[model samples]
Target: MATTNVREITIALRSDGEGLLNSLVDELSRLAQEAVNFMKRTAPKWRSTLTNSIRADKISDFEWDIGPGVEYAPAVEEGRAPGKGLPRWEDPAAADIVQWLATKVFAGRRRARRTSMKAVHENLELRDRYQGLAWHVRHHGIKAHPFAAPTLDMMERSFPARLELAARRYLATTGSGGAA
Candidate 1:
C-alpha cells in the first residue's frame, strides 16, 4: 500500500527558566503554521488535490507536523512509478456500463435462450469504451512533480529571519530584554 510521508522542522530555544516555555511553544506553533501555509502555496497546483491536503498541527510542546495522514501526498511530492499514483475510481463509469449490460441484456435470459445480436453489439461497444479509457490511463501515468522538498529548501533559507522575528515578538511581549 502507498503511504503518506511526513516532513518536520525542529526549533530549539534556550530560556532562562520554566516560565518562558509556554510562550516559546506558542510562538513556535505560530511559526510552524506559517511555514505550513508557505508550503501549501509552494505545492504544485495541478488538480490542487495535494496542495489542498497539506496541514499543520502541534504534536507536542516542542514538536510540530506540517503534513499528516495525506496518503498519495508523498507520491506527488517525490514522484511515483508509472501506474502507481493515479487515484482509484470509487464507481468507474466503465464498470457502470458493464453492470447495465448485465442487468438489461442478461438478467431475463434463460439457459435455453441465446444472446441476441443487439446485446452482442452493445457489449462490444462497452468493451471498446473500457479499453479506450484503460489505454489512456496506461499511456499517461502519474508524473512526479516534487513540491515539498523545494518548499522546505525555501523555508530553510528564510527560517532564520522568521525565527528572529518570532523571538523579537516574544521578547517585546514579555518585556524580557535579552534576558532569555
Candidate 2:
C-alpha cells in the first residue's frame, strides 16, 4: 500500500457522456493489467519479491491504481539518496540481504540451489560481509531502478492510440456515426 511514483491522467468528457466509462471499462482494465505486467517485467529481479508484489486495483469508477504491494517498493523504484541512514528494519543479517548475497556473491555454486537462506543467515562470516555491504549502502545511495517511470512513459506514448481504439470500439458498438 506504500505506493510511489504516482501518475494521474484526467479525461474530459462531453456533457452528455453518460455511461461512457462502462463501455470502456474492459479496455481500461486490460490497460491496467498490462501496466502491472510491464512493471513486473521492468522491476529488478533480486529475490523476485518486489516484482511479484506488483498488482492492479480499481480505486474509483474512472480511476485505476497499478503498483507494488510491498513497503520497500518506493525504495526499490526511486532508490535512497546518498548518506541516508539504513532503514530501521534492515539489519546486517536481514534475511533479504543474506539471500541476495547468497544469490549474487556465490552465483553458480552449490549454495545457489538452496531456496532458504537459513544457512547463509546463520553463517557468522557471511553476516559480517552483509554488514559491510549494508554499511556501504548507507553512505552511497542506491540508483533509481525506474520500472514505474518507464511504464508511465510507455503509457504516455501509447495512451492516445489506446483511447482512440477504445473510443472507436465504443462508437462501433453503439452504431453512432460522427455527427457531432
Candidate 3:
C-alpha cells in the first residue's frame, strides 16, 4: 500500500530554570485547548466525533528548531507590502519550513489515494469531492482551523446516521405499495 503522511508543526524552547518545565506545560495545555476550540468552530468534525475525546493531555509536544542564528517572526501578519495584501509570514524563515512540511503531507496523501482501489471505484461526484480535499490540502494546506466544508472525518462520523435516517424517510413515504 502507498504511504500516507501528516504534517505536524513543532517548536522548541530552551529553559534554564526548574520551573520552566511547568510553565511550558501550562502554556502547551492552553494551546491544546485553543486548538480544540478552534477545531470545534472551524472544523465541526472534532465537535461531533472528537469533542469529548480530546483533551490537553492527548496532545504531545516535540522539539524543533528554527535553526542556528535564525531570526523568527510570529505567524501573524504585521504589515502589508505594496502589492501583497498581507505578508505570508511575519517570520519568513519559520514560515518556509511550515509550508514545506505542509506540501509534503499533501503530496503523500494524494499519492496514497491515487493508488487505492477504493478511491478509484467511487463515483465521479464522490471521488471529486474527496480528491478535491487532497488537492486543497496540497495547494492551500490544512488549516489549524477548519475553513473547508465537512471533512472525511466528519463524513465518516455522521454520514451513516444520515443515510439511515434518509432510508427510513424513504420507506415511510413509499410504504408497502412502493416499488420493491
Ranking by lDDT: 2, 1, 3
Number of the top TM-score candidate: 2
Candidate 2: tens digits of C-alpha lDDT, residues 51-121:
99899999976689888888888887788887854433355536676777757666775542235665555
Q: Residue-pair clashes per candidate, as listed?
A: 0, 0, 0
lDDT of 3 by residue, 13-132 (tens): 122223334444445444445544543454324114333433334424422121112122111112122322222223563344344444544554543365577555533434344445
In model 3, which runs have C-alpha deviations exceeding 4 angstroms? 1-16, 45-47, 50-180
Off by over 4 Å in 2: 1-20, 85-93, 111-122, 178-180
lDDT of 3: 0.37
* Structural RMSD, model 2: 10.1
lDDT of 1 by residue, 28-119 (tens): 77778877788777777655666777887668888777763467678566654445322233347345435544554456654232378766
Give the worst 10-residue stretch by lDDT in candidate 1.
Answer: 4-13
Candidate 1 residue spans exceeding 4 A from truth: 1-16, 82-141, 168-176
lDDT of 3 at 61: 47
